[model samples]
Target chain A: MLDAVRTARPRVQVITNPVAQGYTANMLLAIGARPSMTSSPEEIAAFIAVSGSLLVNLGILDRHRRDASLTAVEVAREMGVPWVLDPVKVDISPPRLDFARTLIGMEPDFVRANHDEFVGLGGADTGEEAVRHFAARNLTTVALSGPVDIVTDGTRIVRIANGHPLMDRVTAMGCAGTAVAAAFRAVEPDPLIAAAAALTVMGIAGEVAAAASSGPGSFAGAILDALYGLDAATILEKARLT
Target chain B: MLDAVRTARPRVQVITNPVAQGYTANMLLAIGARPSMTSSPEEIAAFIAVSGSLLVNLGILDRHRRDASLTAVEVAREMGVPWVLDPVKVDISPPRLDFARTLIGMEPDFVRANHDEFVGLGGADTGEEAVRHFAARNLTTVALSGPVDIVTDGTRIVRIANGHPLMDRVTAMGCAGTAVAAAFRAVEPDPLIAAAAALTVMGIAGEVAAAASSGPGSFAGAILDALYGLDAATILEKARLT
Candidate 1:
């Protein structure tokens, strides 16, 4: 999947929170995927029309972000471009949860969320059940990420267990992970494979980074280095999947 | 000044660009200052009322940022709180330049800018002259950051020659520097000393980080580690100030 993304060099239109923008862009660039963030609602459609995929992250919900995100997602759906929806912190804000539900109704190609967020979005108890339930209900792919990550597309389920605890300390690590999934979705047509590949890459990189880092500060840098340096053989050697 | 900041543990209200927010917050936290970013105009004044200082960064200006920045700066001034103004990329955008000029007129305690931004803001030729010119005109401290950073408070000028070229490769480094200055300003009333100490720390940290990093990605993490581990002895031994 990483090879496919590198080959495609897809340009992804990302409407993420301010906190996530810089790291997300850097991560995409490091992995050979182009990332653009044009928040102006007037120009979002035009930008999305030319991009390969879209990543809609509701991290800090503002009026401008809300309007632009809705417009971008609709445009992506109409254009047949795959998009990833990340319902960040949906459980914390009722308005944000409502916004996530509204976006879920629009039918994003992939829904990426944490275990808590998956439950908040009306999923079942276990990561496997939550992903399977959400994917079946939405008729799309659902990814539940945590210590053990599960991705399902109604029929097929993929489990990846490979990350580090240091990932939790950084502010925008999960948000960047969502963008990676969108990048993979741009290259791989199968939603289950795309979601699984993205999560595997994130996990392996996190594990590699945690080994080399002293704390959260250095862990962020090492993760980027691992992403940039990761090859197919290294991924195969380190990735723990089922 | 660094000692004062460590002792006070000042909470800074930062209304910065989306790209700079995470790093700025991390940098402040590494240096023992608390950072909060409240972009909502409705909540900014109340947030600033309790903050020890304010940092206004104009990197990516939208309607929300413009409105909230103006409101925050006004409240900071009214409440007699020290505020730092960072005119990021002011030369490229005429609208942003005009807005920065208006804010300058409101009299921020410190003005931080690059060489081009200093010139755009009507500073004279050299960094020294530019800082002195702006300081004299506005009756506020002016910090001109580049290869060599110069800080001035109308009469006194402090030159710090210590940063690394790696700093330029990373996005939002200058904006983060401006926040560091504000953090120092919160604990130390002397603008010149505060600006100089902040710049000195940033430079020494950059130099130290450059030694430990392989590229810009790793350099970012090393910078955070350097800042968190920096001590007065390290500063005294490494800093090159005039």
Candidate 2:
């Protein structure tokens, strides 16, 4: 799937939170994917329809993103393109949380979220069973990310433990991960494998980035270099997936 | 101004485009200044009124940002606080260009723009003379940035040439520079000195960051570290101001 992503160089429409537009676009580019980052209502529906996949990251929810997300998802659904949702900070705002639940109900192909976000999304906090239950109920693939990332689609479950704490220090790291997932999902048919493949690559990239970085500032740049430099062997060897 | 910023750690309200939200905040934090990035009209007037300075960066023009900028500027002016404007990509859209001219007429304390943006704002492209004329006519400080950065305020014109090419490769680099300028303007009484000091520090930091970075990605992180580590002597020794 990862190799396919590189070879195909699929275009992914990312309606990312304004904060992560640049990082998400650069992250996609580093992983050999083309990123179209236009959240404008006038352009989103058409842009998302033609994209290989769509990623909606609700990092900082506003009217613009809320309206754009609805339109983009409708078009993606009509066009049958895979999409990923990263519902960020859903625990804080009721309006934002409501919007996130609305997106999840639409059944994006994959969801990349952290513990708090998953919990806020009505997922149980009992680890594997909770992830599987949430995926089963939603009929969607889920990547429960943190120090160790848990990816599942109800039936099949996998855990990838490979990233560094420095990864968390960088801004919009999770949003960038969703962009990577959207890129991988463009080529991979199975949602389960696509989410895992993307997270695995990101985990390995994070570890590689941390090794060469002295602080969060340096990690921001090194991660892109690490993502660009990754080969099958490095991922295969370093990805602690089970 | 730089020393005062570090000592006081003034809060700056940045109505920046989504692309530079994280970078601008990080850049401010690195320089020992607090950054408040909220483009919500529900809160912008209050935020800007209390902030040490306000920086409005029109990197990606949208309704939310437009509304917030207008409100923030009004509040800042009423409070007698200094404000800077970064009219990004003003030449591309007529509507956007019209809005930029509107903002320029309000007389922001400082204007940080590229050569193209300055020209689009009706400034002649003949370098120093044009920059001075624009600043004098508008009764504002102007930082005309390019391979060489020209900071002028009608009467005084200074050129700073110390930045690296890699700085342009990073996303929102110019917006981050605007954030830096805002932080300096918060502490300095003179707008010309504030803009010049900020650009000189940014240019020197870019060179410092480029030395430690291998690519644009690493340069992003390295630049923050470089900004955080900058000292008066290092800036004085490395700055190329003529």
Candidate 3:
């Protein structure tokens, strides 16, 4: 996935939260993806037309952003562009949670979220049960991320154990994670492999970053550097799959 | 100003562009200012009511964010809270430029912008001319940030020569700079001194961060770390004011 992303240099359109916009764009740029965060309803369709993948993040939802996300997803589906959904902070807001569930009906290629958000999407505890529930309904890859990230389909489950606790301290790490899934999905055909590869890249980078960081402040920069410096050999050697 | 911010722990409300949110919030947090980016019109007034300072940035001028910024600034005025206006990217959008010009009549306590934005706000060339133009019209301090940031009122001019060129490569540095001014203004009543102090903090931190960085990626982390570790002695000894 890392080699594919570096070679293709996918152009990704991201409809994300205000809190995640800067860092997410920076993260994509560091990882060799061209990112555009155009949220205007009038302009979103046009931008998604040229994008290699789409990332829809339902965090800090508003009328305009919601409209743009809906439009972009529809266009991405029509164009056969892979998209990833991140239901960020959905548990805290009922309307946002409902909105995310509605988008789930669209059957995005990948749905990545934390344990709380995955549960909030009307799924049960334990990543296996939740991902199995979704995979049974539709051909989608479900990733329930936490201390040890979980990636699965109905038949196969992959658990990644390469992240650090310090990742939880930084803001927007989850948002950036879903974006990595979108970038990987753009080049990798299998949704399950794409989701797991994205997690592997993020987790390995987190471990490397945590080693060099004093706190979350330095961790943010270190993570980007690690991603930029990542290679296929390192990813193949460091990946912890179960 | 740094001492005041650390002691008071001011709660700053920011109505800024999507691209500036994460880093701006991080900058305020590292500087001991509690930051909030509530943009809903329904909640902007309530948030501003409790905020120590308000920062309205016209970076990505959307209707909702603009309305929230306008509402927050008005409420800030009524509540006697100092506010800073950052007319970012005014050169690109005429409607947003006009909107920023209209808000200028509201008599913001401080106006911070780059050379192009200052010129877009109907000010003349060079930081001195543009800032003096605004200062002459109203009792507002104008900050024109560049290689050597210039902060001034109608009667007095303070030049800050402590920054590095690498700061220009990082996105949202100017927005974060304006946010730092807002944080300082929350504690220091005098706008000129407050703006100068804020610029001093950012500039000196930039110099320190640049020395420790290999490129923009590490520089981003180093800047935050430097800001976190900054002291009065460092600022006094490293500040290059003319």
Candidate 4:
């Protein structure tokens, strides 16, 4: 996946919460991809027209922000650019859940959710059932993050069990993971392969962070260090992507 | 300054644009400052209550975001946490200029502005005069950015004549500079010294970026590399603080 990103250097457009814009864009750049964030509806279509992939995150959702996200998704679809959706904290409210459902109809190439969010969206009794539900919806890829990450492409499912438990303590680890997924998706055409690669990398980094840090504060710093320091050879050796 | 930040590891609360949030926070972390972004009026005060310093940015101002910025400044003032203000595009309109004036009245520890913005806010004929105007208004420190940056504490002024011309082409160099200033302010209690250190560092990095790149797109990448690669010794050696 890193090889593909290095070779393609795909341009990724992210319309996410303003909080993560700078870090997410720099993260994409660090991994050898171009990134731009445009939220104005006037600019979204033009940006989507040029981007290789799009990532929509509903982290700082407001009426104005939601309008922009919807417009960006519509434009990405029209341009045939594969898009990923991060339905951050959708289970928090009925309005948010309904909004997520509306986005689901946009047919994102990948949908990423944490354990609770996966269960909320899929009504699944277990992670495996959640994956199955996502597959049944004809979603290209479903990434369910927890103790073990499940990446499925309807017919085939891969489980990555590399990340540490400490990752659950950080504030935006899931959002960062979504950004990583978008980075991989920017380069790889297959959403399943991209999702698998991202989950593996994040999980491995999480483990490395846990080894270095004692708590959430230091863990956030360590996670970034591990992600920035990770190499393809190291990933192949340490990743549990099956 | 790096020694101070490395030792203190201050938590700096920032109320700024969503576009630059991630980059600003990452840069702060790279330099050993903990950064959090909260734009909600309630959340801003809540975070600032525990933070070491406050950084308020009026970069992408709108009706809703302006309230958060105002609330943050008020909280910072009440808490006596040294704060820096970036009056982005204050020169563009009367309303923005008035808004900046109102905040300036709150007596920020430091004021960081680009040449045009400084002139616009102060109604000065030149950047130097703008710095003087800000200093006269009881501003503890004022940094006016141009080809050469002038950082002052009323009586003593340092001229940093480093940096690349290509930096002028980028969109958020000033905002990034403000973020770096906030990082420095988080470490050093003396607003003048902190502003000088940040301005000098950003200037030198800009020069390095110009040497390594052909245009704005490539220069942005090189600038990040320069910022990440720079060390305290190299900064002090090449930095023209006076």
Candidate 5:
């Protein structure tokens, strides 16, 4: 995935939580993508105008933050630029889940959610059921990240039996995956292809991280090491997309 | 530096510009530092309460952003955790210089500045003169970064001359240096040692970047590669710090 972005530099605008802003933006840069992260609603139109893709993550959302995300999505829609929505922890709270559903109505080009989040957003009993619910929503692509990721684009579905269990131990790994998806979207026009590419890269990196670390504490660094070390040829060879 | 941070994980709070937020935070994580980047004044006190070190960067300061930096400094002061300030483009505008001066009065444990920024903050006519002027400041340590970096804690001074010219071609290289400094600070309590380690590491990586890239477009990736690839033995052998 890094190789793809390095080969084809893309301008990506990320409107995310303040917590992971620094790391996410830098990771995008390390992979050869131009990153812009701003939560100010006043700048959303201008940012979307210059960017090729948008990543919206509601990790730490508030009343004010929701407005910013809506503004960004509106501008992205007007510009005809693709955007990825990450409904982080939407299931844990009522207001958050309601907001996530409202955001879904905005017609995001792609939606990246973990098992719990997908269940919450889809109002499904299981991960597989959640994928089916999302598919029915007419999303361009929906990724259900877990031990095995399920990616679907309404009619077509690809299940990636890659990645490591250690990824579940780390906080914000799913958010990072969403950021990687946005990076892939910047380079590839097809949301389905981009989702597969990001999940493959992340899964390969997760496997590398699991081999190098003992616990969640050490896994984060190892994950970054894996991302930095992994190349396109290796990605193509190791990726398990079906 | 990465080895040290991996061994001793530290929680770092960064109050910085939105542009490099993702990359800087990720760089800290790559080296095993927990990074929290929050610009909300409402959350500054709570965030700094758990942080081991504070990093403030004046890269893209606007009227609304100044409040957050000031709040962070206030919280860091109350906590007594070591804080480093990066006075970026201080000379380019009056408001920026004034904000930097106000933050400096709050007493940062370390100050990381580029040649241009050092001269501007230290009230000196040249880079060398800025080093001399900053040596007299009340801060615990001052790092003046350029092709060669000079780190001083009043009595003891170290000069690191290892980076390449290509480093100047890239944007936010100084912010990366500042993030590295925060990483080092998270592990080592000594401000001088942390500043020296960060300057040496960033400089050596810059040299490595120069060897691999033709311009700024490629230098960014090469710089991260150099950082991820550098080891303590190699850094000590090649580092010009004295």
Candidate 6:
């Protein structure tokens, strides 16, 4: 799947996350996937139509991006583009949770989020059974990332435990991971496999980054370097997917 | 000046560059300066009032941010707060140029830009004379960044030539530099010396980062790490300000 993504070089459109915009784009580039961050409503539809998949991040929810997100989600559906919904920090904001619900009702292919975000968006928990049940109910893949990662789509499930604690120290690490998943989703048909594979690659790369890092600042950059230097041999040896 | 910034730990308010917001904030943190990225018009005045300095970046100009910028500038001026204006890529768009002109008319403390952006904002060249001329006409300092960074306030001019070429490969490097300048301006009373000192620190940090970097990806993160680890001993030895 990593090879497929690199060869395809599929363009992934991500909306919101003004804070993490550059880092997310750099992370996508590290994994050999092109990132398009067009969140403007005037030109987002065009960018979305041309992209293979879309990622709507609800972290920095604002009035202008609200309009852009609604338009983007509809355009992606109209164009048959696969999309992921990342309900970031929805637990803290009622309005953000409501907006996440709106994106959820639009039938995203996957909902990539952490445990708190997953549960906040009405999921039971980060437990495997709960994740699988949520995926079955939502009719979308549930990528619940934590100390261990679980990617499931009702019938199929994959567990990947290969990252480092340093990842949590970095801002937008999960957002960046979700973006890589969106890139994989662009080229892969199976939502479960796409999320699983992308998480595996990012997790392994993160482990490599943590080995050489002194702190979050160094870890953040080293992870991008590790992803760029990541090869098939390393991926095959380090991958913890089941 | 660096110690002053670290001791004061002044807050800098950046009004634009959603793309570079996180990196810029991280860079500010690396140097012990607090970064406040508040672009919403409703509350920007409140943020600006408490902030030590403000930076208005015209990189990703949008209708909503335009309102926020106008409001931020007015509030910053009303509060007698220092501010820097970054005319990013104004040559590419007439409307953006017009907007830059409007900000220019409002008396920014400094106009920090690249050679093209400097010329685009009506400067003749990046030469010492042109920068000085621009500074005198606008009643502000001109900080022209390039292979050699030039900072002048119509009279006191400093040229810093201590950065690595790898700095350009990293996205938002210039915008990040402008943000750092804002942090320094908060502590230093002189705009020319503030811009000069900040660029000298960042340029030296870039040189340090380049020593350990394999590519732009690594360079981007390494620069932040380098900035975090930078010290007075290294700054005294490596800075080429004249």
lDDT of 6 by residue, B86-145 (tens): 988776556778999999999998988888788888888777898899899889988888
DockQ of each: 0.18, 0.19, 0.17, 0.07, 0.05, 0.18
What candidate 4 gets wrong by more than 4 Å, as runs, is: A1-15, A19-58, A61-176, A179-197, A201-242, B6-9, B22-26, B127-130
TM-score of each: 0.67, 0.66, 0.67, 0.63, 0.66, 0.67
Estimate the lDDT of model 4: 0.76
| Residue A122 lDDT, candidate 5, scale 0-100 | 61
DockQ of 4: 0.07
User: Model 2: which docking level applies?
Assistant: incorrect
Q: Write the per-residue lDDT of candidate 2 for residues B156-177, one digit (tens) a residue.
A: 9989998987676676788899
**Cα lDDT, model 6, residue B177:** 93
* Model 1, span B116-194: residue lDDT tens: 8888877777657656876898888888887778888879988899999999999888888889889998988888888
On residues A1-242, what C-alpha lDDT tens digit does candidate 4 reach at each position? Answer: 87777678888888877666665776676667788887887778888888888898876566767898888888888888889999875654446667888998889988998866766675555558658776667555788887778888777888888888656544466776887888788778788889988888888888887788644445666777787778878898897766
Give each candidate's fraction of reference contacts reproduced: 0.23, 0.31, 0.21, 0.11, 0.03, 0.24
Residue runs of model 5 more than 4 Å from their true location after superposition: A1-55, A59-65, A70-84, A87-159, A163-242, B124-136
Clashing pairs in 3: none
Q: Which candidate has the highest DockQ of all?
A: 2
* Residue range with the least summed lDDT across 10 consecutive positions in model 3 chain B: B38-47
lDDT of 6 at A99: 90
Which residue pairs show collisions in model 1?
none
- A1-242: candidate 3 lDDT, tens digit per residue: 77778889999999988898878999999899999999898888788888888999987677778888888888888888888899886665567777888888898887888877777777777557766877667667788888778787778888998888666656678889889888988888888888998888999999889888865679888899999998878888988888
Worst 10 residues of 5 chain A by lDDT: A213-222
Model 6: interface root-mean-square deviation in Å = 3.8
> In model 2, which runs have C-alpha deviations exceeding 4 angstroms?
A1-13, A17-54, A58-64, A72-174, A181-203, A210-222, A228-242, B37-51, B60-62, B91-95, B115-139, B154-156, B169-171, B213-221
Candidate 3 vs candidate 5, lDDT winner: 3
Kindly list the per-residue Cα lDDT of model 3 for residues B1-242, writing each as its tens digit: 78788789898889888788888888887777877776776556656777888999998788888888888878888999888899998977899999988788898888888888877777768657667867777678788888788888888999988899899989998898889889998898888898998898999999999999999877877888788779889988998998
